[model samples]
Target: MTRKLGLAGVFLISLAVMNVFADRSDKEVVKRVNSIEVVALDSVEGYEKKYRIPDENLNDLFAEKIDSLLNSWYIQNVFEMPSGGGMQDSLPVVSIPDSVYIDRLQAIDSYVDLSFNKTVKNFIQLYTQRRRDQVEMMLGLANFYFPIFEEALDKYDMPMELKYMAIIESALNPTARSRANAVGLWQFMYGTGKMLGLEIGTFVDERRDPVKSTDAAARYLRDLYKIYKNWHLVIAAYNCGPGNVNKAIRRSGGARDYWSIYYRLPRETRGYVPAFIAAAYVMNNYKEHNLQVRYPDFPIVTDTIMINSYLHFDQVSAMANIPVEALEALNPQYRMNIIPAKKDKHYALKIPIESVAEFIDNEDAIYAFKRDEFFPNNEIINPKSSNSHHVSNISGKDKVLYTVKSGDNLGYISEWFHVRVSDLRYWNNISRNLIRVGQKLAIYVPQGQADFFASVNRMNFAEKQAYKKKTPVTKTTSASTQTSADGKYVYYTVRRGDNLWSIARKFPGVSNNDIMRWNNIRNANKIQVGQKLKIQSRS
Candidate 1:
């Protein structure tokens, strides 16, 4: 029975070999021995090469979105709101004494130097009284973003206080874009974002992906700490870049303290450290500042699923009864609202915890639902179809140029223009909806309507109000249109559940395009039920 025993031994070894192969996480294997597989010698090397940051130069997009966002945070938290109401209604403003501030500073258990000074005190005022409402709002959002940041920081063994740095960088706005083209909550520029392994492409900018970017930021911070060996100097280096920090050090005769090189740093960088300390203090003791600590309404529980097939957001929305807007908000990294997963390469799709089962139950239907409507012919939408931001020619029709105003995003703009959000990005070369207030964008419309749009845009706020005054009755025909008192334009009073897209469908030859063009409207979603809409009268 020696031959039988030999066969049994071989079978047992084969099972052991299968178990060994199952334990490995790498993608490819070369050969199998008795109870182990020989991994390809270059497999690890190939992975490092593939995942390493590529050496390439990219042009930066200049915009004031980030500056305006930061400035608003300053105004909201450092200046009193116009309404006079504050968190400290019963308490005297600026009541904190120097001793109290000093004690609080001394008590802070942080690796970063928490020094009490005029700069820090000024920021404290900004956070406590002047911008209490803004501080409250930041606190609300912090409930959602801070945990993600903390998790990454913990993974890298970095100090948790470093989470406050994102506050100074992006005010917790995941899609925040800076004037220097730095992007995301961390405000990473192209060179740094790319080097940190953030994928920046036509469809996905992982820098805007909250989870991924925070991990990258944590890794970068750990690397910076390794260089400076001091959190304060590391913070300065982060803001001004290593080169600028190095120069500042030389200018200060090789000083390591942030305060010593503060004057030599960039003007913005000078305020950065103080802001970080203020943010940390404000976040920790918000109740003392009379700020409300409300939890954010954002989905706290989410599940990420690996998707290996091409899918459009509409499919998931339609099959799972989730709003497309909700999906877009959750997955902002997908620039075009299209997840370009291929059979060979997989992408992660995150969904709310409650809806995970729904998504899974209807997975097949979601994949096949109206596939053509979302992505036609499997071609990725080109982000650079238009060279200029103004005057797009769609279907050979002339287009209008609309300047983005504050409080505008792709959703509302799409609703306002009766154009798909995808079309807006394709026309403006915009990869994300993080638009600046002053940026101009192209809107295609029927010919000869461009001049009308200019007149609409030129109208003063008072004139626009007068133009769109609502009436009591809803009309079903063009005869229902009301001429403004000045007789220069017509108005339609919106009804319940009305939107630019739905309203545009009601009037013949009066698309959302014409309404937005004639009214200087950009965000269609901003139209409320009782709001009035200006339209060109068919009568």
Candidate 2:
């Protein structure tokens, strides 16, 4: 079985390998990429999860996140994205030569190789020509995010130019989530995020935490750099993983650089490095292309306050005179708009710089304001005292017919029914959001929850909003919480793997001692699953 390869055999093998890579050049990069059949990677095993770009033309994400923002003095005043409501981008286009791009890229001081190529040129045009609106939006966000990224990069001794990677990954949107569930500015999937020490749970997802996620991203890039010793390869590995990059290296016959092994990588990742180059080019020279950078009108200064007790956005809003929207915008990490802090464990709450002293002075009132209503464990009520009725688990098309109240809009109705606004409109065959006071709308909910949703039509506006506050509890919230005429207590049905202390933490200012005393439980550990405990909520 052992036969030495002759010189002729070795020559033929080397020639075949060279010919294969010769065809995998920029000749097909721009014009023929669409025709390249999508590669199936099911066969390659044990590779880490990918957080690749969803599209090279990343205009839609900026538009969608920008449009979804509600009335927050922080969001509305901070980021003013184009309304696209008949107003055109008024900037005149300025076309530039490829040599100009090459020279400009060289001019920017960077340790990473910013070499020019046709693939890079194609991507640069994609940003400058086609996605200029998005470029402007990202340019604005970069003003807010770049300094955070630079600090992390500097701390890790990574190249300063790596900050542009955020533009490619998330358009500098801190809350940007990818199709692969990769969230935050750096597009880190849950697995990679948790690997990099990001806190992910029902309450807080630090992947959307700008500073923490940027730090995580910088550390990850540094580790990848240790492996490849090349920034371009490190960038490619960040899109896919080191496994894919290593696979590409093997298939490319030991080629080390990006372009040499580029064809052997995933199709999405093939454009990744080039897209980074494009991102860097557009971010730096967007002004030269006549693109206007609409920076945020508000100041970016913020101060972090330590939360040692559980806190709700409403409480802070009430006591500190800060809008809940501003609190949420500043800290998108809190999924339920609640800071789930405890005596032992703490989380930081970011407030606008001006409100730092104000918040600290009124911190006690903020924590205690309606603490019993938000956190049910604070005061216990007798189960027998509550007029809570049994909710039957029913099947079939469970529909709730809701009569629109005077102030009800499609957005409010959809949110009340836990359905999409589009779903509400589609179900009722209405084109616009317009609805009269007596307009009947059918809301289809999960098969088991017909009676619960139907009761919304009878509730007053204040009660409906009170019901809305309980929506963050997911399946654990009782259907009868807001349905009772008195509405004295919110019932919490304990789930498996639950304990008194853990249950108490869900509500701010509630402790296990409070839960035990309120529930009248002799022992804290004696509570069973499916046991409903009453926590007081005022009508």
Candidate 3:
């Protein structure tokens, strides 16, 4: 009866006259139920902007939704510099002679500029001093990512030092994006990625796939090098585009030298070459600066499975016991957490190396699990229009405003307000997970619940700041949960505040990876409070 009612509701909603731009009716009608006034979504134009999600939000949403179910699930953690910190505070400047700098540059086998200029020195200071933590994290990630980068560079016969460009492009984040919409570690724009034979579709965006995008970037760099034959100019062209570099050359009276035409280049591009040089230097000499690599506990080893039929992340998570978040982290190419399998198309799903046999053994069961929930009725939209993502809310609820705070995402905010992510997206008319600090968001809820948000809205910024600081976030596990017997599996019941990262830390020899593999725990949603987790002791 419930299923029939749901289908009937879906049918009735589909029949309602609507346009791609909005859910609107021509006449404004006031609807009141139990003395509560409610506004229909279509009645307001551009109402979705009230809840607008940013383009960079999907991964954040996935992370927030899952929490720390799997240890170190980030496929590529984007390296961003600390907003404020100084070189004087962290490390002292060591005076090295100009001759030593020149000799070091000469000893290097790279074609790119290794010259010790003021610009290069400034960036070097920025990395070794102001951004030490970011650089240290980059060094840790470099251990895993650098080999892949070197392979691609070697395959294309490019300079090995060119690998550092990924550091500048995206800080080695495969899912990195610029405000201009350039994407991935290589930061390829849509046109360039498409031209390089990268497949981008509704279901899959290959730009977010590290291996494929790195190959594309290598080819692009090689092609640019072919034209200029100078690595510095090639790097400049890569940043500001070939047209701008060419214009800079013309402005400098056809000067081929990067430094000679540097003044004519874009302001940001001027810093680009220097930063690249600094990145290469820092990666090579991180230990000298007292920086240690902060590597993730998750192993680099993984295996890929070919998925020919439609596969949802939830199916893989439930049947294979791989956390859905891990799957998303490994296969970020799949937007909407969907591996759309057409009859003629094949998709690749990567999982931890240990989970391969289990995945195969349960392949049939995975495909058969919850088919209806994963692939529901195809929501109709105007494929031609950009502003076509619209969700209809038949349940009349009043909209409330919430101010976004520091360390907030859609998932966290949704949980706090007791609202669905879909509803948050629908109210704001945004498709992605990105929201900004201090941005106001519109949330719809019952009239009786209006006071809750009203109280939140009444608080000033300073009051909110104080409240956030007063609330302690870190959770600790009991000492009893820490000890495990050798050659046996111990079961620990999940607590309300427990996450995989914390759980792994409770046992000395155990890691989140071990827990993920042993219990088939992958998705954050799969693990709940009071759930029993299997812990295999390595001791």
Candidate 4:
């Protein structure tokens, strides 16, 4: 009887061990699913804090929603793994009650249940005081853009939630430009804009035209969706590129979903999709976060008219009895208030619908008045007069009207003139860098601005200051000074916040390419934050 009892006890112990192993397998699967990160909740919390939302109830609601969304069983399945036979389990199960999983779920629940308190608390911790002010300013502008974005997305059969893309891209600023030269509300780079049929030129970048840009963005998003067959990946590709997404997928070993491949993406790309999702969530729950929309000063109703003449927006505004600010807001693409010099083709002009008839009635009179006002000094209006005066007065006079020769382009001309292609275009109304043979080009060899040159002469200035202070002259000079051959030329030391365009504009006659050449820069796009250059005198 004693032997039988001992055998029974051993059998029961074996059964218990098997049961434990099975439980472990289940837990491992849960662990893997929990590993999937949901970045939107944290981002929303940060945004909310930055905005200083005081309402407790609204904050709680957002928190609750975020928790529900993030803590779903689907997310767990994706992130965690099952546990069973210590390394022998075929299917891994997540370990339930793990601190990470429990805490994450609890945090989500806390956000939902705590009302405005959690959101406000999260917001306060997320942003600094200055950022909070910027957030407030951004919220004011959101009213102007959100409606337009909503309408455009609706037309494209896209989700209304996608309107938040503009908020993330530009804070709804139609004229926003990124460091990479991505412009306007959609933040499209030159290449991508061109691909989407957004025309860019000196006078107008269609990327800045809100209506057209939005349309292009919608179509681009649709195309991305068609390629990836996923809205999340489409948003990711919008920030980084479709190629990047594809590369990330490959890196992730052919993981088909966003979270699975997110870690394999570039740092900025990883953040971008999450930021977008967060923006969508926050915008939808803005009221909960105590965000109030400040209505724009202009009326929503507007009209479009066809304009054949080379007209100024200011003139159109005056003729139509519309405020210049409103007109500018409606048509941000006109960089200098004037439309591109079209000879016969008509361009669409947006005006207050009520003002359309008034604009038509006074079109001729308005054009005449504007011409008179702008050309009050007729001598200054004539390019020939200015050129003649420049030739006669300026030293280093070289009279060369070089008709563009074959194989000659803006870059070649810029290299020849020691000027940037950008500056050549600015001076000569050249819309693009492309130049055809027989195209007449103007070359200006600046002369005689000793004082201007002296002002930027870093070596002499630095030596003089050092002498005055009776300090020892020591150490290597800055990059800007080093580039100057004689150490007598002016050098613009690139500061932390300096850019090529701004630095070029600071000194007269120094073209963008001149700065590049002075710095021995191969690619204009690759300038670092603190790269300096010599400033050769243009005058």
Top of the candidates by lDDT: 2
Report the lDDT tens digits of candidate 2 across residue range 175-259: 7666667888788887777778899987889998988998988888887776667788888888877777777877768777676
Better of 1 and 4 by lDDT: 1
> Between candidates 2 and 4, which one is better according to lDDT?
2
lDDT of 1 by residue, 1-539 (tens): 00011111221111111111244444643334332212233343553353221111110111123225434422232222323232432234566775666666656677776754556666777667655545565675676578899999999998999999988887777777766788888888887787778899988899889899999888877877766676877887778777677677666666566765667877667777777887788787777756764322224456888888888776786687554545665787888878889989889988766678888888988888866545557655543352333333487666878787766677656644445676788888888677898898887755554543444344433232222211111244444457789886677778754555445534433444456656676443466666678876532
Candidate 3: give its CA RMSD in angstroms: 22.8
> Candidate 3, residues 270-350: lDDT per residue as tens digits?
777777876777777666667755444433457889988887876787687665546666777887777887559887888
Worst lDDT window (10 residues) for model 2? 1-10
Cα error, candidate 3, residue 111 (Å): 3.9
lDDT (C-alpha) at residue 144 in model 3: 56
Which portions of model 4 show Cα errors greater than 4 Å? 1-130, 341-344, 372-539
List the candidate numbers ranked by TM-score, top first.
2, 3, 1, 4
How far does residue 97 in candidate 3 sit from its true spot (Å)? 4.7
Better of 3 and 4 by lDDT: 3
TM-score of every model versus the real structure? 0.58, 0.60, 0.58, 0.48
User: What's the true lDDT of residue 468 in model 3?
Assistant: 20
The models' CA-based lDDT, in order, is: 0.62, 0.64, 0.61, 0.51
